[model samples]
Target chain A: DAMVIQNPRYQVTQFGKPVTLSCSQTLNHNVMYWYQQKSSQAPKLLFHYYDKDFNNEADTPDNFQSRRPNTSFCFLDIRSPGLGDAAMYLCATSRTARDEKLFFGSGTQLSVL
Target chain B: QQQVKQSPQSLIVQKGGISIINCAYENTAFDYFPWYQQFPGKGPALLIAIRPDVSEKKEGRFTISFNKSAKQFSLHIMDSQPGDSATYFCAPLSGSARQLTFGSGTQLTVLP
Candidate 1:
């Protein structure tokens, strides 16, 4: 099954510590996206990569960054974890920009203590 | 301003009843509307989608009724079951950016 996969389904990090979340896809899609979803709220788009071209959302915090070294792998790096940063991080992929359906990974539940 | 607004933060329906979730969007440029279903501790999955050009689209027991003039779209789950209990989200995708702006989401519980 061609699907999106995320590593470390549950992550625990100390305050102000740096952490990285990973996502890989067998779908080989060109566009990869990272979203932060808090409890009972909509998933907020952090950034996305269009085959190595990074596009960050205007309101995304400076502490959040993403990297897509190749077509299949993307990583989300948190420069400094905060208690407010505890949320589910979702990874999604799509083949094209125009009305294409997004495939999402199970997500990484980050806990900042 | 929130581009999309969803109604009824939560809903409870009996099994075999109808489940309806509604959403309204402020962006007139949005051409694509999609509904995603999310389970606890999991990512949202695309359940169904519709385009502004069409008034309605149906797949299996799920139906999306889109009112382009009103800038509102809704999802109707027919013959709801316990397995259908999950969070439902409605999103509208802007045509130019193809980026989706989602609603707050509605948690639906279907009692068996």
Candidate 2:
């Protein structure tokens, strides 16, 4: 099935260490998004790629960065992991920018220790 | 401003009962509303959606009741079952890129 896939379902990283999460999609959607979700809170948009153009949320931290190497692959890089950065990282894709529904991946559960 | 607000952090319902989750949004420009269901360790899936031009929409056992004038929308799951237990989120989309503003989320448990 055409779907979004994330690598390393569970990731454990040492404090201040760098970690990278990957997402790939078979659906070939035009828009890809990254979101950070802590326990019981809404998923916060970190950044997204429209084709190859990157859009970052105003409040996203500097430690968080993303790259869309190509149409089907996107990566989230944490410059320095912190305890507060432990959360589920979700990747999603949509066909277009207007009123389009997103399809999400299972998510990477990051644990910063 | 936190554009969206959701109620009932958690809810418990017996099998075959009705499950309702509510959300309100502050953005009047929001034209699209969607409800997503998330299972443990899984990503959220689109359950149903509605537009401000419509008051309600139903798909199978899921329904979205939208009150455009009030800036509120709700999801109603009919004949709820254990399989329906999941986290429910209501979101409104607007502006360029149509970025979604989501509610905090409500965890629903349907006892079998």
Candidate 3:
């Protein structure tokens, strides 16, 4: 089935260490997004790639960064992991930035120790 | 101020009963209202969505009642079952930004 996929479903990193979460899709969607969802909270958009155009949320911390080398792949890099950074990282895609619907991946659960 | 507000931070519903989740939003250039269901350790899945022009849209057991004038919308799950339990979020878009903003989220538990 063509779907969004995230690797390392569960990740553990030491405090202040760098970590990377990955996402890929077979959907061939041009818009890819990264969301951070904490316990009992809604998913928060960190940044997104609208066909190579990187749009970052104003509130997103500098520690969080994303890269989309191509249409099928995207990556989230944490410059320095913190306890507060531990959360489920979700990847989503849309055929176009204006489309109303989204396709999501299972998510990468990060644990900062 | 939160752009989108969803009610009943959490809910417990019996099997075969109706599960209703409500959300209200401040008017903007927003055009799409989407409801998502997320299971533990998983990403959210789009259950159903509605446009401001429509009052209601239904799919199978799920229904979205959108009141554009009142700036509110709701999700009604009919004949709820245990497998229907999940966290729901109402993320309305400002045409297309940051998902515009996300609702706090509601955790639903359907008892079997």
Candidate 4:
């Protein structure tokens, strides 16, 4: 089945260390997104890539960055992991920018020690 | 600031009962409203959505009642079951942005 896939379901990083989370999609979606979800909270949009164009949320921290090498893969890089940065990072994809239905991966749980 | 406000942070319902989750949004420009269901250790998946032009949308036992004038929407789960237990979020979409503005979320627990 065509779906979103995230690598390293669980990740542990030390403070100030850099870590990367990856996502790949077989759905052939044109839009890819990254969201940060804390315990008992809503998933917050970090950034997204519409085809090759990158769109970042205004309140997203500078430490978070994303790269979309191509349509099938997108990566999230944390420049310097902080204790507060520990959360579940989710990756999602949609057929188009206007499409309402989003297919999400299982998600990567990041633990910043 | 929470663009959408969801009531009853958590709820418990018995099997065969009805579970209702309510949300209110301040953005009048939001034309698309979607509800997502998330299980433990998993990402949220879109369950159902309703456009402002419609008053309600239903799929199986799940229903979304939308009120454009009041800027309030709700999700109703009929004959709630244990498998239906999960966290539900209200995310509204505005034309200005391609992404969604999510509400705080509500945890639903259906006991058998």
| Candidate number with greatest DockQ | 4
Q: What TM-score, computed on C-alpha atoms, does each candidate reach?
A: 0.98, 0.97, 0.96, 0.97
Which candidate leads in lDDT? 4
Better of 1 and 3 by TM-score: 1
DockQ of each: 0.83, 0.84, 0.76, 0.87
Sort candidate 3 into its docking category: medium
Docking quality (DockQ) of candidate 3:
0.76
Quote the positional error of residue A35 for candidate 3 in Å.
0.4
Q: Candidates 2 and 3: which is better by lDDT?
A: 2
Clashing pairs in 4: none
For each candidate, what is the lDDT? 0.92, 0.92, 0.90, 0.93
Docking class of 4: high
Q: How much TM-score does chain B earn in each model?
A: 0.98, 0.97, 0.95, 0.97
lDDT of 3: 0.90
Lowest summed-lDDT stretch of 10 residues in model 4 chain B? Answer: B92-101
Top candidate by TM-score: 1
lDDT of 2 by residue, B4-96 (tens): 999888999999999999999898888889999999999889889998888999999999999988889999999999999999999788865
Cα deviation of B109 in candidate 1 (Å)? 0.1
Tens digits of per-residue lDDT for model 3 on A1-113? 73999998999999999999999999989899999999998988888888999998899999998888888999999999999999999999999877878889999999999
DockQ of 4: 0.87
* Rank ordering of all candidates by DockQ, starting from the highest: 4, 2, 1, 3
- Residue A106, model 3, lDDT: 95
What does the TM-score come to for chain B in model 3?
A: 0.95
lDDT (Cα, tens digit) per residue for candidate 2, span A1-113: 73999999999999999999999999878999999999988888999999999999999999999999999999999999999999999999998766369999999999999
